[model samples]
Target: MMDSLEGEELCYPLLLNVSCRGLMRPRFEAILLYTLFSSITVLTVALNLMVIISISHFRQLHTPTNLLLLSLAVSDLLVGVVVMPVETVRFIETCWLLGDVMCALSYIIGFTLTSASVGNMVLISIDRFVAICYPLQYPNKITRSRIEVSVCLCWACSFLYNGLILKDHLRQPDRYNSCYGECMVVINYISGTVDLVFTFIGPCSIILILYIRVFIVAVSQARAMQSHITAAAARKVPVTAKKSERKAARTLGIVILVFLMSFCPYYYPSLAGQDISNDASSWAIVSWLLFFNSCLNPIIYAFFYPWFRKAIRFIVTLKILEQGSSQANIL
Candidate 1:
C-alpha cells in the first residue's frame, strides 16, 4: 500500500530519483478542468475552421482584409489543434510524459503561432488604417496579391524568428530540465528581454498607434458625414463604401481590444522585470487567457460580421458542398 501510494506521487515511479512529482488535484476538480479545457479546444478548432472555409470557399469573400482574417484564422486554428491540447495536458497533468523532443517542439509551435497571430494583427491594423484614413487609395494600396505576399512573409518571419529565439532549446531539449518528467524551457535574461521588446512591446506599440489613428480618423469621418457642408461637398463619394469601411473598422477594433486584454496578463511578469517561468503558480491561468484569445476571435467574427453568419448557415446546411457555391455572393 505504501509503495502504491508513493508510486502514485511520482510521474515516473520506476525512475523515482529523476521523476518530477505528479499533480494531486481532487478528482472532481480534475474532471471539471478537463471538461472545460476540452470544450475550449474543440470550439476553437471548429470555429476557426469555419472561418477558414468561409473565407477560402467564397469568391465574394476574397477581399484583402478577409485574406488577413484568413491568415489569423489559420494561426488560431494551429493554436487550437496543436498548442491548446499539449498545454492542457501539461497544465492538468503537471508533468511531462511526451518526452524532451516533444517539449521543445511544443514550445516552438506555441511561439510561432503566437508570433504569427501578432503579425496578423499588425497587418490587419495597417489594412484598417489605410482603409479608414485613405479610403480612396485603399484599393490601389492594398491588393489581393500584395496581401497574399504579406501573409506569407508574416508566417515565414514567425517561424524564422521563433526558431532563432528558441535555437538553444531546440538543439538541447533537456538542457533546462532538472528531472525526467519536467518539461520546461528557460530563456536567459538577455534573450528574454529581447523577446519582450520585439514580440510584445514593439508589436503592441505599433498596433496601439495605428488603431488610435484609425479611431481618430473614423470619428472625424463620422462627424464629417453629419455635417451638411462636408456631406454636400463630398456627395460624389460612395457612401456605401464609407459605411463598409467604418463597419469593418469597428469589428477589427473589438478584435484588437480583446487580444490586448488576453495577452497583457501573460506578459505581466516580463513587464515587471521578472524572468518568465512556465511553472509559476499563475502561469497556467495567464497562459490559458492568452490561448483563449484564439477561441474568442471566431466568436467575435460571428457576432460582428454578417457574412460570417451567412457562411456558417450555408456551411452547416451543406449548401457549400453544392456546385458553384464558391461563387455564391457571401457579401
Candidate 2:
C-alpha cells in the first residue's frame, strides 16, 4: 500500500513536467527570435549613442532642433539599456530569474524613459510646426526656459504615472502568474490592462491627433506659401526663405514616418492580447519587432541624413587606426 501511494504521488509532478515540456517548443522558437532581435537592437543603440555623443562633442550641430534630436537619442538609448536587455532574457528563457524586485525596477525604468521620449517627440513636433508657421513669434514663444520646463514636466509625468505601479506591487511569489510564465512576471492581468490603456492607447491617441493637426497645418502653410510667392514675384521680392522651410518640413515628415513604423509593432501585441493565441511563435515575433524600435532610429538617420553616413565613416576609420596601432605596439 505504501508503494502504491508513492507511485500515485509521483504521477502528478511527472504529468505536469511533461505538459510544461510540451510548451517548450514555442518557447524555444521565441528564444531564437529574441536573440536576433536583441542583437540588432544593441547595434542600433550603439550607433545612436555615437551620434548623440559626437554631435554634442562637436559644437557645430548645436541648433535647437539638434538639441531635441539629442534628447530623443538619449531616450532611445535608455530604452535599449533599461528595457530591452531584461526583456530579451525573459523572452528567450521563458522565465524571470531576476525576482520580483528587479522586475518591478525594470517595469518602472522602462515605462518612465519610453513615455518621456514619446512626450518629448510631441513637444518637438509642436516646436517645429510653430517655428515654420510663425517665424516671428517662434523665438519669443519657445524660449530656453520654456523648453526646459516642458522637458521637466514630461519627466515628472512619466515618473509619477509609472511609479504608481511600483507602490502596491513587489516581487512576492504570490504575484507570479505561473500560467503565463515570464509574460506575466512584472504585472498581473489587471495591471497589465491598466498599462495597455495608459502607455499604448492613451499616448498613441494623443500623438495621432497631434500629428494630424500638424499635417493639416503644414498643408495650409504650403498653400499660403505658393500664394505668397506669386504675390512676391508680382511685387519683385525674393522667396528664398520659403524654400528652406519646405526642406525642413520634408525632414520632419520623414522623422514622423520612422517613429510611427518603429513603435507600431511594439504596441500591436498589447492591443491584440489573448485574441492573438498567446502562442510563443507569434509573441516572439511581435516582441522582437518592438525591440527593433531602439535600433530603427539609427537606420532612420542613415536614410534621411547624409551627415550620419559621414559620421559612420569617421568612426570606422578611427577604429581601424586604433587597432593597427595596438598591433604595432604588440609586435
Each model's C-alpha lDDT?
0.85, 0.60
In order of appearance, the predictions have TM-scores of 0.89, 0.67
Instruction: Report the CA-based lDDT of candidate 2 relative to the real structure.
Output: 0.60
Please write out the lDDT profile of model 2 over residues 196-252, one tens digit for every residue. Answer: 677666666665665556666666666566565665374433244455456655665
C-alpha displacement of 57 in model 1, angstroms? 0.9
Model 1 ranges off by over 4 Å: 1-8, 229-253
lDDT tens digits, residues 222-277, model 1?
A: 65655644546567555654785677567657866787788888777777777777
Tell me, what's the RMSD of every candidate? 4.0, 8.2
Q: After superposition, how far is residue 265 of candidate 2 from its true place, in Å?
A: 6.0
Question: Residue 129 deviation, candidate 2, in Å?
Answer: 1.7
Best by lDDT: 1
